[model samples]
Target: MAEFDDILARAADGGRIEAEDALRLYTDAPFHALAEAANAARERVIGDDIVTYIIDRNINYTNVCTTACKFCAFYRAPKHDEGWTHDNAEVLRRCGEAVDLGATQVMLQGGHHPEFGVEYYEELFSAVKEQYPDLVIHSIGPSEIDHMSRVSGVEVDEAIKRIKAAGLDSIAGAGAEMLPERPRKAIAPLKEPGGRWLEIMEAAHVQGLESTATMMMGTGETNAERIEHLRMIRDVQDRTGGFRSFIPWTYQPENNHLKGRTQATALEYLRLLAVARLFFHNVTHLQSSWLTVGKAAGQLSMHLGVDDLGSIMLEENVISSAGARNQSKLGELIDLIRSGDRVPAQRNTVYERMSVHWTPEDDPSDDRVRSHFSTIVADLQQKA
Candidate 1:
């Protein structure tokens, strides 16, 4: 107990904790003690007065994918009847709706269609920027970049540069399900290597684009492997320092190829959250994933070192297809944060506070700012 207390004290004081210390804290520390240490660490970096959320939309541009990852339920083979790609016009329409509902960021995410390469992204990104110049296009990840580069017969750096020139604001850490070889291969064997993911992100950072780091729990990965994921991210962050935040989400087991597997328990998720805060001394923000875990767990995470409530995902399909049905409205999200004894602030893609909700009166209501409206998926299903 004394040794654990000493480690916790050092971590709460903003000192770095090694991988072994993190393992002990994650596996052996009492729940309340771990939460206290993590909250203290968070307070030492980000103040405890406010929690943040984002108003963003996830636009799945296509469902055709060649990489048939074992854990994915969102993609269809290219020649499948259910596979569909949104025309540029429909994509623009979704962005318009998102903007009208006060979205500051649009995430253009989808599977890797062999026919769609870097040029496809360049044209789409440029069109979005030309129309909605203010919308932050924080979309895609290292895996997508790698796929696009390969399909276009270009180098990875060239692909990143072309997309950035076409108005990509930053990258999202989506494909980083796990960074260790054992678990990553077991879940996503066809996906790029974990080290390659980090290297592409490093190249993006060098080219002046920032990104977030993510890990998807409950993919049958061991606790040590979870810690290893964080270690991999932290090492890369040590050199590039381009990761603005670290987000960890749980895997949705229903309707996916990894079906019949149990999701990670809420307690495990909370423990990982605390450990992540203590481990990533270099990462600035930690986001709570209310979209994957239940709302109750997300609310409790506020006290366990989570400072961001991710987004009130205006529309989501990929995760929804895998059975994540939790939803939140604009006002409801603010109340969720405020109920945790923290003010709610709306932030842009870059973590800039756009508006701060200091009190109930400051909370705005917009029914159109829905948490779930999968028009694309619905339309596709109807057509099918």
Candidate 2:
């Protein structure tokens, strides 16, 4: 107990812990003690008075993918009858809906289509920006850049430059399931290597395009591997300092190849969140994943060093294709934050607070701000 306390005290005193120490804290530390320490660490970095949530929509443009990852239930094989890509009109219409519903950002993520290359994205993003100039286009990740670069016969840096020129405001942390080699290969063998992923992200940052880093836990990854994931991200952040946030969400085990081998319990997820807060001394923001884990666990995350509760996800298809059906409305979400004794603020894509709710009366009652299932999921339900 004394040793653990000393470690926590050192972390509180601004000392960074090593990977082994982090693993110990993740595996051995008591739950309440870890949460307390992490909460303190969070308060030291970003004050604990307010918790933020984003009003954004995830518009999956297409599901036609080539890399058949074992853990993914979101993608369809190339030329599969079930596969579909949204036309430019459809994409713009979705963006229009987002704007009408008071969304400040739209995360446009999809599969790596064979025909879609850098030009495709350039045209699409340019069209979106030409129409909805105010909507922040937070779309794609390193793997998508790699795919587009390979397909369009250009370099990753060139691809990022083109997309940014075409009006992509930021990159979402989409393809980083697990950063270590073992788990990454086991789950997603065809994707770029973990090191290559980091290299591409560094290139993006150097080119002045900042992005978030994400890790999908509970995908049969060991505790050591999880710590290694954090270590790798920390190393990158130490150099470039471009990562806006570090988001760790759970891997939903359903309708995919890696069937129910193992899943992270709520306790395990919370422990890792606490350890992540202590370990990631360089990263700025840590987000909670209510989309995969449940509302209760997400609320508990506020007390365990999470300052952001992620997006209300006006429309999500990836995780919902897996078995996570959790959804929230604007008022309900605000109430969730208030129930945790924290102020709820509506934030934009760049983490800027658009509005702050100081009391219950201050909360907005816009029903259009709730989550919506994707058309694919809606179709599946209708068939069932």
Candidate 3:
């Protein structure tokens, strides 16, 4: 285990962590030991005793997906009667609700609607920005861009430019269900190729659009594949440095096609978190998957290596449709961070500091700002 110890030492000293070392840590390192090393690395890389959260909402504009992945429960078949797409007015109304509850950012995600193309998103984004000039539209990802390019008969770079010019703030790194070819095919066979996703992201970065990278683990991917995911993202970040953060979350197993047989355990999640902190030395922030992993696990992640607890999501549907039951309010998020013995702060989409909670007096009095209390799906369905 000298190799493992050496890797740990390197991480503690703020040195780079290679994929082989990360694989060993994932396979052999004790849970607590890995957490300690990762926490130390976190302190060196970002800072100790400070955890960040953002106030945002996820707006799934459509449930109709042409490329229905085996691991997804949120997407409806394109011709399925259950399929629904939000109109511009409904989209704006949700944005208004999110802004009313203190969300500065909106993640405009959706399934790959076959009929919609680049111009569709351009008009939607332009309309959103026209109405709500302040709300940051961190919308769509590589999968949507590639799909729209094919539909609109334009190149990926042109689609990204059109969306950016139409007020798309940044790409919401969702299409990366898994980076490796084998598992990516197993889970999301019809989505864009792994290399194509990275190429599109790099192209977007080249055009001045920064985005985060995400990994949806479990669904039967191996430990080595997990490490490989980190390696791919690290290589990209090394080249473009456009990735703002790396957020890895476990797969949810509810209404999905892949059932619950291949779920990643909580211990495994923590191990990956620690390895991520050490492995992603070039990445600026590491966020927990509290929305999928639950609050206790999320709280534990900060001590393990996560510098950010993600968002107090004003609304979410992707993972929720796959059985994410956990929810929290802004005050509760502050308490979750405080319980971990770390200071809590409010951050924007780009990790900019918005507010910090030092004491009870500094807390917001409104406890009703819940993370998952309101959802666009429920509101739209109820109205329909």
Candidate 4:
């Protein structure tokens, strides 16, 4: 029987591990065996289907953030002219547009606005649900919960319960850049500590809310720090089984306070993706960010163990604000997945298959195009 270390040792030898083993695999194991084992693990979990993506849109409700993290380029302070908030009607318009364009989910993310208390989200979420009951309100993160609690004078658990009761379907892991305190403070000094992030996530999980986990790489953190981030999430996952997926994205280094000096490389991203697959044994879904890394990297990601290609974001602003730029058309995304020898499936927030395209031969024609566009931008000019 193969022990865990033996499996890791074999993976290291085969050039399949890096990042740290990525750091060590180049020197440690027989590269072939390491690659074989990692590949086998990927195959065993994801199988040969080559997982695809969802046609969803990210509707950033507001840019007004109170936490002035050093590494952020998206948040706008209260007095900053760029700071703005989306009202319920505007948020619903975005949801309506997403639903019109066949988007199954709307990733509603924003900063920790000091004044936009729990009532704001409760109203916004309830309105969205009232109008677009079918649209998955996969919005908010732990940071928002923390802020809402502080603003409303409620506890974290209470805030989560109210938001969930209003309409939030699931939480998205946004504020988790690096779980280590040293790196976290260096990058996002105003945000909650690493333990608090996990605690809030665990509370959300216990309250019947499922969420995803994320890591922002290349912020000058050590490779060991990256592994520690994974271990932290893995530990919580071991306890509650609440995290649905683990997404590892490279930090964009353009307009943010943290400049282009130390962005995670493509090879580094792939190594982390592969290592994430190996380390997070209990996490089921591993998503790749085509929006941050280019489509080529996203395609290569499948070979490295990413089962989901994330969303075909009709609109994305945060990373774009930071100077990361990549977009994929619906047709092109399907083609890319097939090109990698995988079936393309559109999934909702919970990974349920809403639609699946087996071959290019079954592609939708011109008549189907209008409806798709309608779902994403029917009321783009509407204000929030």
Candidate 5:
């Protein structure tokens, strides 16, 4: 196979690697060549060897979902015996645990509960903010916002505005499994359409709210469909410049409605990671998700153009409910980045540096910062 010399050079040199160009890299390019190109692009754009992580929690407020995506094992039907919704006080108590352990951001992601309209979110956000004035409410993506708008009999714009006014800090960009039709429909037919997700994201961006874009690959999506997903996000980003980071994670195949059909291998995941860093030139950050793909794979991503290694996720439920059992403590995460031979720094939702650990001595003493995926109220009070 011929090396993708020309394309690699183009991507590394600040040229916009088009969709077709990305496709070729995914298919024909030498694996290491693609990685090097991606790493070069990452350093060129973000600078230095400093990789960033956020001290955050993935909080699932309610598991009762109207959109029961086949790929999601976290959601429960409203009438189901196991269905549950955490009260605002419960949510607040969980946030307190996260904040005590050094978390600055909380990802309030869950399923689209049928009755959770704009007002529901408005109250939730308002209370969360009032209690934890310093914690950043990086909650809600476009799909949930669109669903809520319809539930409340309002427009997407109005839904977003009301939530933001109620102290929503930013969009989490969850639920963007795959932006193209084939794979999208194959996985999440009940969720809002893929294009509508982007539409809502752009609207939020226009209204001065920034978001991090995400792609959930390996859900029977072809390489072409994957590229198409990047294309869709890129097009929207060109317009609003709202995507602060691009995060690509593989699908978990446990306990979901899907047949557990096809999954992206580690190599394929690496290819996609490099392709994103190369293709998304306008995006400032590329996050490597260890929570979904294990710690080692996440570390490998640093050499393949990932500038951020995602979070020290204090709590998670969605991915775990689907059998994603990988775990990491703050010390282990720092070690993983160091094993990749890169420096690790703590970052906020917007990629602002909070703290940098240049050496082991710089590591924090708080070891209670492990992720807790408990749905029980009692477990939420107990620190990991």
Candidate 6:
């Protein structure tokens, strides 16, 4: 407990805690006590107020994937009957709906379908942007870039340039599970290497696109490896400062090739959250994953130094496809942040505030109501 307190003290002072201390925090620290200490550290940094979330939608445009990763349950093989591909019109429709409902950003993620090369994304993104000029297109990750490059016969840098030129505003940190080669291969052998993930991210950053850095935990990686993942992102961030946020989500074990045998505990997630706050001192924002850990754990995560509650995803299929059980309402989210003694604000893809929601009444009504209102307006217009 003394050691735990010492780590907490260091974090509160904005001092770096070593990897060994981080391991102890993950393995041995008592739950509520650790939460309290982490919250104390968080208060020192971001203060007791000002927790934030984004009004966005996660649009999975396709599920046809070539890389059959053992840990993923969201992707379907190319020939599988369950696989789906959303046409440009369908994708645009989703974006239009999101915009109509007041979503400021759309996370456009999909699998690495062999046929959907750079041209496919260019057309899809261009269409969405052409329709909704104000909507932020935060889409794709490094693995998709690598796969698209290989499939389209283009260099990684060139692929990034074309995608950004089309409409992609930022890279979603989806593909990075663990940065070390050994564990990453064990979990996702078919995906790109850790070095290549960083290299492409650097390439994209150089081409004037910033991205989020992420970690997928509880896939049997050692504590040292997890710290190393943080270090890798930290080193790159030191060089480029291109990463806007650091997000770590636990691996959900259900309906996947890796069954429900292994998962990160709630305590483990918080420990990592706290450590990430202390370690990645250069990274300005740290986001909590309510989608994977459930809303309660996500609320506790803010105390563990997460300033952002991630997206209030109006539509999500990836993590839900993996068996994550929690769904949050916008009102509930505001309450969660307020219960944590923080003000809740809605942000855009770039962390720009769209509005600060002070109470549950401040939340906009549900999308279904807005859709009904729109239908009424159209009918009245036709009658006139």
Pick the lDDT winner.
1
lDDT (C-alpha) at residue 314 in model 5: 77
lDDT per residue for candidate 4 within 218-320, as digits (tens), equals: 8899877888898789889989999999998988887777787788888777777777777667777899887788899988777777889988776777777
The order of the candidates by lDDT, greatest first, is 1, 2, 3, 5, 6, 4
Which segments of candidate 2 are over 4 A away from where they belong? none
Give per-residue CA lDDT, model 1, range 1-384, as digits (tens). Answer: 776999998888888889988998999998899999999989999865689998889998999999898778899989999898988899999999899999999999999999989999999999999999999999999999999999999999999999999999999998999999999999898899999999999999999999999999998898898999999999999999999999999998877788947578899999999999989999999998998998999999998899999998888988877878798888888888898888999998888888998879988888878688555545656888
Candidate 6's error at 237, in angstroms?
Answer: 1.0
Worst 10 residues of 6 by lDDT: 369-378
Tell me the lDDT of candidate 2.
0.89
Candidate 5 ranges beyond 4 A from true positions? 1-3, 373-384
Q: Per-residue lDDT for 181-251 in model 2, tens only? A: 99999999999999999999999999988899999998789999999999999899999998989898888
Q: Higher-TM-score candidate among 1 and 6?
A: 1
TM-score of candidate 2 on Cα atoms, chains taken together: 0.98
After superposing candidate 3 on the true structure, give the runs of residues whose Cα lies further than 4 Å from its correct spot.
1-3, 376-384
lDDT of 6 by residue, 1-384 (tens): 766787767766777666667667766777676667666666776764678887777787888998998988888899898788878888888788888777788888989998988888888888988999888999889999998888899998889989898999999888999989999999888888999999999999898899999999888988888888988888888889999999999988877988966788887788889778877667878898988888889887877788899876777776665777677676677788888778888787777777887766676656342212222123333788
| Each prediction's whole-model lDDT (CA) | 0.91, 0.89, 0.89, 0.77, 0.87, 0.81
Model 1 residue 50 lDDT score: 82
Against the correct fold, how does model 3 do in TM-score? 0.97
Candidates in order: C-alpha RMSD to true structure: 1.3, 1.1, 1.7, 4.4, 2.3, 5.6
Deviation (Å) of 322 in candidate 2: 0.7
Evaluation by lDDT, superior candidate among 2 and 4: 2
